[model samples]
Target chain A: MSSHDHHHDHNHDHEHPRLSELQLRVKALESLLVDKGLVDPAALDVFIDTYETKVGPRNGAQVVAKAWADPKFKAALLADASAAIKSFGFEGRQGEHMVVLENTPKVHNMVVCTLCSCYPWPVLGLPPVWYKSAPYRARAVNDPRGVLADFGTELPGDIEIKVWDSTAELRYLVLPMRPAGTDHLSEDELADLITRNSMIGTEIVTFPAKAQEAAE
Target chain B: MNGAHDMGGMHGFGPVLQEKDEPWFHGEWEKKAFALTLACGGLGQWNIDISRHARENQPPAQYLDNSYYEQWLHGLEVLLVEAGLVTEDELKTGKANGKSNVAALPADRVFKALQQGSPYAREIAEAPAFKPGDKVRVKSMNPPGHTRAPQYVRGHVGEIVMHHGAHVFADASARGEHGVAHHIYNVAFTAEELWGADGQGGAVHLDLWEPYLERAR
Candidate 1:
């Protein structure tokens, strides 16, 4: 049978040897801890549950939202991104020397870690699967606009899109243009405007009203 | 061995795995591990001994079971704990205290400041090593580890279009052992020049590094 046929047949099924092995190891490790009385299985379960719900890109979204609302703050962000970002109390590994690129009418910005998926995790959280995917890493540098199109982002033909590849030395975070109709909104409301996908340049942030209208 | 980023032409094996759709805590430990590795390198305490051994002798199946990030985290933990930068107890305490101990700057503020052209003033002020009209060729070297020079671009000649100031080197093999300041360059190449007339684009631009180029004859 052809590969395409095989793929269609298994459309709903997926196999991950690595994940299975990991699950097995996790169980084994948990049992070991329980047997040694070092930790309780229930406690471990609680910890895992809390971590899953509480830890994520929401903090990054808040930072992106604040930048969208304040111009001087945006200026500070552009001038010394690392220090400015620190003012909000977010900092770290991939974030050591963070640089923020603004997407404007004249020019747009997209970031990629062409070498081994170097991303600003502390702010952006874990990169989307596509960010680390081989197709993205390879095509983004060569055909940025085309790739953006695939992601449902199509810039005006006149506008220029500058693709920035993050390296070990400096990391990048994209500041997407704030959607219109978001004025008069509170900081928390604005923070709600930001999405992790927007920060990564995959999707544009939409105002809730506009989004709701569209959905309707 | 191949560079870490060179995964092109290897797609047909299986379906794409969407990491977001997976359970939230699935890769939490793994992400911590990956950050620790980067932190160790940032703090100047990276040791490749274990990595080299792992790559050479190959660890047990259990070791391979964890995601790449998990392995990286374990490696970082081993190195940092051994070096006394962090103790296991401290790590646990920090975890209990809520959030990993790594420091971070706010994302939005950083973006705003950089847009105002105030952050990289000193670095930007320094004149570019090469100008827009200068002709340069990508350097030819088969160094181990990750490099910005895509295999297709090696030995190809291009012209400097713009000069982005000094940036960090992407080659982990070089920077992992010794600190080096690598600069980024915007080099433009005609499609015909790199891939002949059949190449789709009229001209291709590459943001290459200084070491990736030499003066074109």
Candidate 2:
């Protein structure tokens, strides 16, 4: 979703010491690896580029759009998410075991790794800094509605909020409800309307026209 | 090891540090740490679980103080030493004393390996203990080692909604041991059950292993 807003969190202010020492430790480890030739610098560069530039939230958006369009695919996705996602070549790493939670008009779904930053890497790529931050991890489970509100997503009191706590063994991906008045739009355009936060359950996917109307 | 990494339901780390335009890798060192960790992982010396334990098992004070990537770097060192890829002396001195046994990841293969990521699922013949729609209580034992069960869920009852065939148990897998496959389930817990009636009442769904639960009386 949005960056974890921590202005009101007073506990964090007194915790977490300086980091200059950690920087030196990382530097030492890298130098050792380079000297040993165990890790080629060029290869390391390729690794970083692959994750940062190649894999991303766009992959998850495509899956969501396809599910919205095809009922069969949606059933298959909810049945066995790992296989359905792997069919799209989004398999591996933090996403080994996936469970897709469908969001309906009565129920909303959100995800947070309470223990650690266990996110679906192949589909959503690496998690945003906020997903891994201390406050979001602690509060997402305790105050999901409040967390969603911070992201500017307000739901009716009647709709139930369902928060999923991700773990190393399994990862959760939220399939958000489709926005109305865009039945004629192509799948590509529908995918465009989906934001990373929408799939994370903090925000909902609204059509461009609707977003503009709300802005006005 | 009940380390700081277990943040569920704990208070006081302020709002998520939102970035308007957050660039990957806040600095070059973070990039190096990320790449190096991936490169070392490519050697097949350890599984993802081990890497997680290395990070999670850190001394509480150190774990809380370090940044995210800094934790990654710290975990990498633990793996290198435990896997015998490097010695503590080498890490401290930043020197390679002898010829290496582990082959470096070739640049050309880096992209391919990343694309063809390894899957952690394994085949298990034993039937699952609990079934969907069954009421169960999360085991309350305070394990001395790494665990996926959170502090809040232990002893609380929930309903099993789905079964994810079989996968490696992270508790054992984190020690570099595999084949301890167990059925995983999506257990649904009510908001009021987890944090009393004062909480914003709703539901919380968690992917829990069969071992973490017992039939609720």
Candidate 3:
């Protein structure tokens, strides 16, 4: 029964004064390092720069794309996800026990980590800031329909929405159904249709041709 | 000190302000500082001894000053410097240059890579000890350190829906600060089993580790 309260402000004046000393020490140490010139600030800068520009959920998207293209692969994916995923060559932390949930006309899947940020890092990379936020974790389980509405996803009442809680042992990634008008595309072309938001069950993969033709 | 997952009870920790649409790394230094303090306190003697007593004995305020990620960043910074990966000066320079030593990669690429092959491509191993449709009970016991199993769902019984390959264990106590072996599984449970009649209306499934479960009768 949760309703959207977009006006809610989570920040309040509950500041604790105890951390001032620690904050000062950190600032002082940072200043000392800058003065010493032993560190190259550019390295940290480049790291952030690279992540924003290059690293993200492309791997997850590729997995979804391959699943859509090959029926045998999709069957294998649903039957033995971890092994099927390995056939494509992805691996990393929290990805050992990979499970692929298909979003169909009757059933939709969404993933959340109520314990912590237990994500499939090998596929989805680091989770988005919002994924780890408290509001998302709480509302996702309590009022899933309302939460999905916030993300602009309106599910039909007849469709059963399954919200899966990711614990430490197993991690989840959603394989959203392929968008319409993508029947003739190749696997590589299909890969571009997937989005990170789709894998998280927030949005669907939209056809690029529709947008391109509309733009004209 | 409190557990790492006890973040919800902290003040000003309910939701984030939507209007503050700043860059992702806003207040980066503050976050790092918070993580360092928590790690020092949570890791206890192990961290302090390694740090040569650099961290003070007093714990910081529960959640008022910095967010959890900030604390995580801070902890990483301290550990990296301690491990001689980078220095305090290097961290500062990285910050000033708008870079982070540890930045996440693109989700799409990461997912693509994972699907390309098994993560442990170098070490080929045998299949898992269990299979689908097996009745298993999640292990019930509270260890003294970080665990992947949530307190609410411990000891619950579920069916083995899928068998994921080995990766890293989430039980930090057994695997040291960071776990080594991965004992992963997808366990499906009926809502009634977990929450009794209240949850009987629908089914609730879970993905758990092998160590977290035992063969259920």
Candidate 4:
């Protein structure tokens, strides 16, 4: 070992060199809370399990697909989102007050929580790291086109972009426009095309060439 | 409060880095942090607004430097200490000083509680001050406490596009006053209005409460 490297090992002999610093901190906090009866370890597991298994972007895909397949459902979703979403048993937490913004040929809708990472958990699930990151939060409202460029999303100049800053308790979901060539697909097949980003309004749903060929 | 968490228009953070097929929790610690925060929240010592304030009220340098879960952990620590559920020494030592009298959230109830998340909307007798399509101006005032109003929208004029019923006022709720409701509206501002000549060709909508706006004359 280099002499400089050896010099920095003076007090490191007893400490855990394997676990990262953050892991150690978390371990310490969890044990402390559990010991004092402030939190149950099982409850923690439930939280993790719930998000990992029961909830996610797939739920949002189902909603989007249903909207695309049924005009009545689409009207219901745009009119009273909370009730419509509740019908699918996706009601709670970050989704109490729901507003589904429909993307059309003229207007594109994007969602962001500039103040904090407020997201619609019931539908879209926990926010992706980029959504919570500072760059997305700071620029999504001001330089949205620039931000979209980062995601490789280029929109036509004539189409107006609408950025929704989730500054209150109300949560928003972007109902992306169904791709033109997707009419031949079933609701399940349509749901397969909906990505979390599309629901967040960062990307537009595009009919994959392979899928179009299969349809043909 | 005008903290770093209220970043809307200020720049130089760089392009967003998105993970390809990212997992729900990036690490083992993140899961714990998320769970601990939510579990403690069920203890009823503090409200969601207060917990948010705890995160946003941190030192600007540290607040911006920490990762998403790290920020949540820091806020959880602050809330625990202030709520008298845990102590600084206990955190450092990784040992509990004594068993807290507060009841821990039962594991079985976690699902139901999560499914029935706290609803902030409340019914108020008075009608909203403005309606859809009504022009309004965001009042310029800086309060040194928790506020949902982003700094970029302050002093700018916008038009109301939707009216959300009265909801619990976050500013007051952060100060421990519960049930205070205010009418909130989705105010739409042109990109040019918010950013001047440098603005992009688009619009920004903010869910602003009644107190933050006034009729545009």
Best by DockQ: 2
Ranking by lDDT: 4, 2, 3, 1
Task: Give the runs in model 2 whose Cα sits over 4 Å from its true position.
Answer: A1-24, A209-216
Mind giving the per-residue lDDT tens digits that candidate 3 earns over A1-216?
A: 112234334343454343565456566544433344322343334334434444357777777888898898899988877778767666644576678889898877888876556678667765766777766665555455656776656767777767688754456889898878899999877877676767877665677622321100
Per-candidate TM-scores read: 0.63, 0.91, 0.63, 0.93
Which tens-of-lDDT digit does each residue in B104-146 have in candidate 1?
A: 2222333332223212112434455677778888777776544
Off by over 4 Å in 4: A1-19, A209-216
By TM-score, rank the candidates, best first.
4, 2, 3, 1
Compared with the real two-chain complex, what DockQ does model 3 have? 0.21
TM-score of chain A of 4: 0.87
Model 2 residue pairs with clashes: A3-B18, A4-B15, A4-B16, A5-B15, A6-B15, B1-B145
Once superposed on the true structure, which residue ranges of model 3 sit more than 4 Å away at CA? A1-43, A72-97, A157-160, A169-171, A184-193, A206-216, B1-24, B27-65, B77-130, B165-167, B172-183, B196-203
Candidate 1: regions farther than 4 A off: A1-15, A24-56, A209-216, B1-4, B8-22, B27-128, B131-135, B156-176, B179-209
Which CAPRI quality tier does the interface of model 3 achieve? incorrect
Ten-residue segment with the worst summed lDDT in candidate 4 chain A? Answer: A1-10
Report, for every candidate in turn, its global Cα lDDT versus the true structure.
Answer: 0.54, 0.81, 0.56, 0.88
User: What is the per-residue lDDT of model 3 for residues B1-217, given as tens digits with 9 covering 90 to 100?
Assistant: 1244423212333433332222334454544343233222222223322221121111445322445454454454566566544466666554443333433233234333323323322222645666898888877777654555665566778888766566455454332443255456777766567657544133445666667878887
